[model samples]
Target: MRLKVDFHDQTETLTPEQIVLIENLLNKAAEIEGIEEGSEVSVSFVNNDEIQEINREYRNIDKPTDVISFALNEQDEDELAVIGEGIPNLLGDIIISIPKTIEQADSYGHSFERELGFLAVHGILHLLGYDHMTEEDEKIMFSRQEEILAAYGLKR
Candidate 1:
């Protein structure tokens, strides 16, 4: 599959290698999810303050989250039936807080790369309609995340 990732770095915490790794991880995640070829995804890195503002404005949860995903192709069954095929889907955007990622990494006692990969995979799954709002959903989603991360050598 041809996955197009548009990366926007608003923070200086990510090195070039880290950025490349993230792109590769996103590509792999897309492949694992069976996303359509030529699909597009956007990733943005922001500070805690900026992410907190977004969380408050969009999610109404006034706290800084490690990552937030905005899926673009979400539609009801009726809308989906009317939608035409053969077009590349715009998956959505993922916004991550650099500081929060670092904090979580330290707290979880994992490398920065592993933590970042986990967050990115988590966000990508969200774009693919995976959620953790319930126990069963959380199990499926978290299992997929661990599978992808472990396959990528980002094991806990």
Candidate 2:
């Protein structure tokens, strides 16, 4: 899949190769999910301050999150039909807090690549209507995220 990826980082902590790795992860996910080859999605890497602002505005939360997904087809009843046909679904926009990602990665004792790949997959899963509001929901959501990451060779 073709992703119009835009990663804006104020700290410049991630290198060019890291961006390439992220791009690869996104493409692998799109392919696995059967999204169209030319489907477009945007990825934004930002500091905690920006993400906190977004969280406040969107979710009425004043805290910064690791990732947030804004999907255009959220309320579309035809989502299943659209995806089943393997059409160019405008998946959505994903915003990730870089500082949060690093913190989580360090806290989990995992490499930055693994953390980023996990977060990217998680955010896209949200765009695809996956959520963890309950124990069963968490299992399904997290399992799918891990499956996508492992499929792309991103293991923790």
> Against the unseen true structure, what C-alpha lDDT does each candidate score?
0.90, 0.85
What is the lDDT, from 0 to 100, of the residue 96 in candidate 1? 93
Which lDDT tens digits does candidate 2 get at residues 5-92? Answer: 6666666788999889998898888778777667777788889999999999999999999999999766666555446565666778
lDDT of 2: 0.85
- Per residue, candidate 1 scores C-alpha lDDT tens digits across 1-156 of 468999999997789999999988888887777877889999999999999999999999998999999988888776743346766678899999999989999999988899999999999999998999999999999999998887777787
| Range of the 10 consecutive residues with the lowest summed lDDT in candidate 1 | 79-88
Shift in Å, residue 44, candidate 2: 0.3
Clashing pairs in 2: none
| Candidate 2 RMSD computed on C-alpha atoms after optimal superposition onto the true structure | 3.4
Per lDDT, the best of the predicted structures is: 1
Model 2 earns a TM-score of: 0.86
